[model samples]
Target: MNSIPWSISPSTRGWRYAIAVSTVVLVGLFLAQGADLVSEDNEMLLYLGTLVFAALYLGRGPTRAATVTSLFILNVGHIHPGFRIGFHKFQYVISFGIFLVLSEQIARLADNVRREAWQSEELYLFTQECARLTSPQKVLELLCQHARRYCGLELFASLAQIKGAPLQTPRGIYGWVTPAVQGNLLLDSLQAQTALALERIVQSERSRQASVLEATQKLQSTLINSISHDLQTPISSIRGSVDTLKTCELPDQDRQVLLDLASDQIARLQKLVQNILNLSKIEAGGLILCLRWISVEEMVAGVVEGFPAPARARIRWQVAEEIPEVQADFSLLSQLLSNLLDNALKFSQGPVAVEVSAGLNSVRLSVSDQGFGVAPTEREKIFERFYRGQTPRHVPGTGLGLNICLGIAELHHATLRVEALEPGSRFVLEMPRKQEVTHV
Candidate 1:
């Protein structure tokens, strides 16, 4: 609800009072001269009605002024003698006294009613505004604004003790109202509301904090468990393969098989450790990009060559004839594509397709596999750190690859998204054809 405009200037109020009094006086004179419908007593009653109107709508000063003006106009113009202040009858004096007393009593009642109505409206507005706000600081700011606008008071909230009369709640002194006047019921109500709002905001913030702390603790627990399992599996495999080779006399082929098994486990361990390091660097804002213009064919060739010969046999690559070179960090971009290919190979069977296509202003690299496609609901979640989806086969992963890819894509000012194909999932990375590198 909007507030009443009671903050009129003294000059404006004086003009309004003059206009009201003049209109009443002119009507009274017109009745006395033009129409002999009302006697002198009735005319006085008419003036009394004007006084009451002033008391109700124009406030105390106007009411008192109108009372005095009504008495003078009645005595001079409408009394027994024409246009003269001669009190020929004692009854006139008593009538005048009665009118004055009535005006004062009515004015006092009207003023009290007006004040109470204004205070009620202010309280309603304050409560409504406070209800919509969630921050204690915002509520405090609202309190200060309300006090200044409605009460002509300057209010301030402080953490330390205020020297002057302070508006205090049960919790503590949140602020003070300045330029002390006599204690007012409206101001006291505002103080109480402010305190209650602050308490509510503080309690809400505490609950939110508690919920976040609980979530963080849960995430930390999950990370610890996943890391432990990932670390132990590789270490156990390498240890077992080494012990078997050391203990038993084996055929040349068997020895080579064990050696290859140990090597695979070691490679897996290295990848995990490297992923952990990359994640930390990304999170810490320490991963600096060494940007350069690199051809799409070269980048794809480099990433494909990193895989073992057998894994490479299952990979296929295609690059557009008129493809443009993109500005990116070669090492980071290679890592991103390698992670995507590795993820595709682990989840799918048959062949993995690595395709590079050029758009009007960007280049897109998509790694698609003939494996079980990602769930529609899990596509976005798969990019969150430590998030693993339900898969048909037990794919060995720490769930950090896609997240790392996302980080690298962001660093290159690119976008990475997964599309669910009919019997496969395609992960697409799009990078701008040209980039402005402010710092290398």
Candidate 2:
């Protein structure tokens, strides 16, 4: 009902009026050319063509223009008495004018539809962001606002991950809640799923935090219990044996054996301490390798030389003759090799074999044992900190050997994988072929 300002405002009535006027003009011309066949007194009937056109397209002004032109021509041609703008003409003119007015009103309806569509797009994007955005509270508020705009009705706004559930808003509960409390109505079949999904994201984060904390606490407890027992008995025996040797004059050969046993125990304790420190460094994300080009010969020889004779006798070799040098930290690389050999020997019933191979862009060193092999499913998860092979149950280990080996491998930008063998598991360390960077 509001007045439409005189502009090219969008109106279907305007479109209809323009169409109507064109129809009338074309029809009126046909009637004029066929004047002989048409009635002189009923000449105004020719303008009906213009009326129909005006009714469909043109507004009142244009329709009136067509009417005036039709009237003027009729008067000048002596086809009728001087101009007669009669009551009937006034009625037709007014009817067309009213039609123009109604078109403007219909335009407002069109505008409302356009506005609704625009708002819908905005709300859709907002809803999507609400689903994907970080911070569950912000997502909750966004969903609630969008739901209000979408259905023009809202019941509740909230996010549920572990604990807190905000309630009593406009949009009804879309199943994020436990549904125990009132106000979050469980509506049938709707698409506010993202809100519920947001809660799940929070739950996942909480679950991860809980698991990490538990693993850390477990590692700490295991280390304490293990260190106390592993170090205590060996140290006490070594001290008692040394004290006895100091008092009693024994044969040189017997004294050397006792000394060797004590030394081995001391070395074992030192290795455990070193492993603990290395594991701590890795957990803190501080593991770094002082990388250098070390020949494969050097790496293998170094690891073998450090091994006690009994262990070394059990190891066999299948290394390639022309083994290329690898970029690695010498100490860490040796430890990585040593850990693999130790794991192999510990698990193997008999001989352990080491093999080195090369591919297009990488080199692989594998240590295989004939012990009880690993299952395929456990291979990927074995690298996680303190994850032991076959769960060590009664065996004495901190379970940090493989994890420390992993950290060392990672520092060298290498990958470690466990391959299941028929008799045992083969551990492979693969690294990209290090290319020399020459200065320009």
Candidate 3:
């Protein structure tokens, strides 16, 4: 109640009093014109209309003013003695007193209603504002601002890590709000609500942190397990070959074969590491393309020749006679082709067809292999990092190949997609032709 000032603005009070006086005077004159039909004793009864109006809108002061002015006007203008309170006017006095008491009670009730309405509106707006805020600090700041504006109280609200009660007032201050009686209750309720909201936000943040920690732990376990299994075979092969070379007097051809085997294993290790690094860079948003116009035929031929003899023998091509050059990063395009061809050869014994065709604005290079095509549900999932399918259990892979290829294609502004053929899976790379074609 202390937070709510009892007085209205002088200008507003003056306006309400003016309206009350004008209404009373007009109604009194109207009654005077009908004097013949009404008795002098009943004239005060008409003023009740003006008094009720004043009570509802004009508050106690203006309503009392209206009541006093109406009684004076009745005693002076309509009484038999005319402006004198004689013996016959005692009944009029009694009526005036009853009207005054009734008006005061009605005004008091209206004032209570008005104050409750104002408080309800302020609390509702505060709740809406709090709902829009995400941070606890912001909610506290808004709470303090509303306290100062609505309650006329300067509050100091802060989140503390103390034990004991939820709200503390160790300073022995009356309350956080002014006029310590009702204000204390209001402040207590508000503080408890704010504390509960803050606690809920804190609990939510803790849950989110726990979820992130659990995900990180799971990823760490998965990477360690996957890399360990993938890397162990090649590493053990290389170690065994090196040990044999060091301990045994093997034939020259056998030693050469072991050396080649070690070299191949080392190359495989390097490729695996490169794929992992590429994926990390892509995830970190650091993959940048060094694009240049390049001959599609030569790039595909070079990539095909880099494969092992048996793998190279499985590749066949039908490139267009005069395919236009595409703007792309050379090393990334090579890796993309390498991953596709490796995937095809790993899964099927049938020859892999490397087809390059020219369109009006783009060139398409597709590698199709006659293997069990990707499952309908697993088509898109296969392109996710470290995702492996159920088929080809005997094949060795880190499952980063297709994902890395997809990232490189995106960096080069190309599109990569997979389609299920009748007896094969076709992996297509469509690069926009940004340069003119030249006959070789």
Candidate 4:
């Protein structure tokens, strides 16, 4: 809007000319009233004053009218042989021409100054508005709208004309120019501001995407590292045991031992596979709860009984008689308890303790292992997928156990946390009390 021409239009010329004529007549009357104080030789000063005032305030067209009116007033009203300029003196003629040239130059200079100042103000406002906007499409649309509305210029924009390595954004690439005022500084500055804003938006999106990609890569690497040893070791053991039984005529006792070892390894493989599948199901958002109200004591006892005989011997339980039954998915709760027990056996040296208690609003189940406790810094890390703690390097695990436990707990709307005990670590699961389940 700032580029609007300062030139007087035909419609405005009539009023401006009238103002010029009125000012001239008024100045002449004032000079005549003070005629006794003013000399004929200094009469041109009054005429020159009117011209300068009009040029400064009313623009070039009005200034020209004032100059013409001055000449008529100077020759007819004040000069001798008033009605004709032919009788004017040589010095007076030279003075009149000089005044005409100087006044027109002043008007032209003033008009140029006005135009430059308006353009500067417009550029300032354009940049301020562009700075506030972050979206490219809105900037392009505003640019076009402002150009037409303010400057009366049509802005032509295209991606091809934009100079630089362009950004591919949801808003797409946009470049704009005021075709009629192609090399205008105001247009150039506006376009530059827009390009800078677009660059910032693109860089922000790229940075966000890079962070997500880095996290995904780290997760994939962790999963592969965890499963590689757990899967390979069990498969190799089972394969070697079977190969021995096939090749040699073994005694019955020896064959039985080999078969038992193979069966144990198979079981280990099956457990690892199940953990992997459960973790996948949780991550893929496919977990569904078949919630049931089951006796807390029975669930705890069953999980302990299902463990290997040696592990079962080391597990001690303290179940509160008043502990309330919990609402949970039966199978998922079983896996969750089994994982907690397995983790305690794998990490602890002394007997592990399973404690169940009830609060006013919730039931709490905790497994405490008497071993080297988790490091303070690694407390939260232990629950993350495939994250092995620093202390138990020799323990056989894929680091997926606790993560599976966490998922199962969440599905039942429960909380699982690890507390570093004085001499070991304690894992606690709390299930909130809810209304009786609607059977499905």
Would you estimate the TM-scores of all the predictions?
Answer: 0.85, 0.60, 0.74, 0.61
Candidate 4 per-residue lDDT, tens place, 181-265, comes to 5566656556666666666666777898999899999888888887887788888999999999999999999999889778878
Which predicted model would earn the best lDDT?
A: 1
Ranking by TM-score: 1, 3, 4, 2
RMSD (Cα, Å) of candidate 1? 3.4
Candidate 2: worst-modelled 10 consecutive residues by lDDT: 1-10
Candidate 2 per-residue lDDT over residues 291-343, each given as its tens digit:
68888776887788777778889888767777777776778788888888877
Local error of candidate 1 at residue 113 (angstroms): 4.4
lDDT of 3 by residue, 13-118 (tens): 7787888888888877887788888775567667887888888877778888888888777877776435675547467668767888998898889777876666
Candidate 4 global Cα RMSD: 7.5
Q: At residue 34, what lDDT does model 1 achieve? A: 56
Ranking 2 against 3 by TM-score, winner: 3
CA-lDDT, candidates in order? 0.81, 0.65, 0.77, 0.78
Cα deviation at 308, candidate 4, in Å, is: 1.5
Residue 237: error of model 4 in Å? 2.9
lDDT measured at residue 195 in model 4 versus the true structure, 0 to 100 = 68
What is the alpha-carbon lDDT of model 1 when measured against the actual structure?
0.81
Q: Count clashing residue pairs per candidate.
A: 0, 22, 0, 2
lDDT string for model 1 (332-424, tens) is 899899899989999887799999999999999999998988998998999998888785435677788899999998888899999988899
- RMSD values for the candidates in order, in angstroms, are 3.4, 10.5, 6.5, 7.5
Please report how far candidate 1 places residue 210 from its true position, in Å: 1.9
Better of 1 and 2 by TM-score: 1
